[model samples]
Target: MVRRARPVLSSLGPVTLDRTGVEPLHRQLYRALRQAVIEGRLRPGERLPPTRALADEWGLSRNTVVTAYDTLLAEGYITGKVGAGSFVASALPDAPPQGGPGRGDARRGVGLSRRGVALAAVGGDMRDPSGRPFALGTPDLNAFPFAVWAQLLARSWRVAGRGLAVDPDPLGHPPLRAAIAGYLRAVRAVRCEADQVVIVSGAQQGLSLVAQLLLDPGDSVWVENPGWPGNRAALLGAGARLVPVPLDHEGIDVEEGVRRGGDARLALVTPSHQFPLGVTMSLRRRLQLLDWAAARDAWIVEDDYDSEFRYAGPPLAALQGLDGAGRVLYVGSFSKALFPALRLGYVVVPPDLVGAVRAARRHFDGGTSIVPQAALHRFMADGHFAAHLRAMRALYADKRAGFLRTLDRCFAGLGRAEAGEAGLHALVHLPEDRPDRTLSALAKRVGLTVPALSDYYTASERRAAGEEPVGNGLMLGFAAHEAEALDRAARELADLAAAMA
Candidate 1:
């Protein structure tokens, strides 16, 4: 009689035996299965060997194989059906689409476009918040001196009868402008008169005003690649064609800026702490950019977003400070340093552009709120603002150190963390095989949230479309958490990373 042929076992890839026994059998099985799924050796909806069969083949108990399968399911490596056993999860690569379906045509019949903007597309989600959530650009509210600010507000309001009754200047309150000018001189080394300062709502408003002042439709505006998405959106919304200049360890490639010559009229830069990458623009590059601007007669919008939190050494002077020619429009915001809701920031315009900016401001919001301006003026004049920065600098430094230490212990040799010298967040680069969405999804499962670095890019085509792109990483914010809480959060993140790996 012919014997029954043995059932063909599904190949979950080769599992190695650890004679040292440091690695657990279940972990080895899980890793092998995970690799198979991730590497596409195990196709989506393809059935795997039954737990009993796998266990028998591998010389392990049924419980061991079952445990491995359960782990894979929990981590989203594979899916298990009631009667059909287990199969690999669907794998969709995240890369820029190669001329796929048109967005307008695909949703033509549907009225979904009338709804609010997609949060994922714009990088602003309702779920973004402070308190150990890894939300980028959020300041530490607990560290802000509310008591001192209250006193300043009360004092400003007490004198409000005269300050509020009078019609405020279209260029913002004079005292506040003077205070800002003084602070910029002392801190940023920017030489600006009070009249040159135009107080706007925030950096976004400043950007809008700059766009209105400079851009004619179809004008070219050079923005940093893998930079701030909000700025790119604002520029595009104003109808200017965006030219993304690639960034390196030194900062934006100045030579590329010269090479992509067009009717390029503006170049926006975050020189102090280059946004997501966190590298400061070298003095040579800063001078080169300024010279380029001067040669082209183009405007440079220098966003000094979080320059005040530099911990390693003395803060670098603002690029506006070094502007011998009147080309750099320096923008500063109290939002990152103070609070987001304050809606207070000032733009130091070139003397030539001040009148136009003021005219644009009048047509826009008719100038910022009077009460907050008065209170902020009082805050600046009373030295409380400096004190606040001093306190926050120390606090943020400790938190930054804690985060770096924890990440070092966790990721170790797996990958490197870039731009930890300054700013609220650091850009952690992952392996080419890892996708940021996977990290984000895994992080969410463990109650942590991280902003994907790719979200900052200007062009959607820059990132892989369907499957999560390989150049995956996170922009981790440290400003919002206390040192102790940050340490705890880091440990939790490390544990998650190990499990995912």
Candidate 2:
């Protein structure tokens, strides 16, 4: 019988093994232990040292070591039984097979690229609430007009009994597509025919369809640096070489975009209200980007994710409306304005790309739920959609104002909060001395749910010109909170920041 080696505790960096620093001893130990486990330095099923022995060795309190072990157990990095101490988690079934890449030497003819190998190495982690009373993207379910929607849904079922059971059009239900087209033209100023509209499950599906149609492996795709992480992930997952274009106050730097060279085949932009940063792209840059797309024969993916709630100014014209050269694919969703779980959004493909996107949609999921599509069509055609948007805009605007007021009252002395102008979230740039991750960690300790802008950056782009590290700011979602709740949440967040300071 062979004996397994005991797991060795590895240090992430030199630690004083004392609890005197800003970070608690338990947290420092937890991070160090977690890093070792993730790096595979601690093999699966290996037993860890007893907490008391570890504490004695590290000159720390037994409670501190126990807390670190508890954290590891909670995170599934280690397992514990009543009588037994914790051990490294059993080898994950999905973990790479032993002997690594050469294990598949018999299939050497089945060539996979370096990027594929790299992507395969990535693993998933469970998402947990930050535990702070901070505002997140989840909407106040009470505010959703579920009763009216239910009525509409019932009416839809009544009107389309047997038809509802049939497969929907690949482009979406005809009535729904027409309704969406009309709504976009009326509200967003987007000129699109029903034929161009394809109903997708959500913005994510739309992105996937666009990626399928426009992206080829190794194609350079420009995405805003401090933008939507999901967009970056989707583009990269589609095998495009992501170019992180820096963002300015007016949104993505158009000139920097121009300098990135015009050869990049696609640019995914959220022009109405840029995510994380929450800056609107200026009209001048919008035109310039369109021209650049036309000149380079590149495609523009205009993700109008949450443009309906313009608290300060009139909503800007969607870039799709200005796409005379048909280089833009316009995407919009009911998720933000109405509700996220609706799982309905549409993409207006350029005439040439319509066939490809339609074919892709057919293979992807065929179409969105016909019942929801019909109900949405009814909602829009009957003016209910416009009414709902007006109510939500007003509610979100008040919530935004309340959030700002709370920041002004509680955090004014700490630092200035960026007036997001129009979006679910605002970016609060903390003092340069206060790292965003530190703030986020502190906020999480206090049960807040704010996301740092640094979390949105692509792994490769996170390093500076010389590969030095950089920090990003926090994203505070206000739309999810009621005016009163937003104020309370902001105040709580302010207190957390003040404590950190």
- Taken over the whole model, the C-alpha lDDT of each candidate is 0.75, 0.73
Error of 1 at 90 (Å): 18
Best by TM-score: 2
lDDT of each residue in 402-422, candidate 1, tens digit only: 778777776775656765468
- Model 2 worst lDDT run, 10 consecutive residues: 122-131
TM-score of every candidate relative to the true structure: 0.75, 0.78
- Report lDDT (Cα) of residue 495, candidate 1: 65
Residue-wise C-alpha lDDT for candidate 2, range 1-501, written one tens digit per residue:
322223235533343444455556788678667767766777788788899998777767999998788656644577765568778876432223221243244433235555444344333211223323445555545677889999999999998969989887888999889888887888789988999999988887788778867789889988887666566656766888877787777788878877775689999999888876778888888988988999889999999987888888778789899889998899888876777679899899877877887787788778788889989888888888888778888887777777777777777877677766677777777786566755664555445666666756654423634452444567777665566766777777777678656
lDDT of 2: 0.73
Report per-prediction Cα RMSD to one decimal.
10.7, 7.9
Candidate 1: list runs displaced more than 4 Å.
Answer: 1-127, 460-471
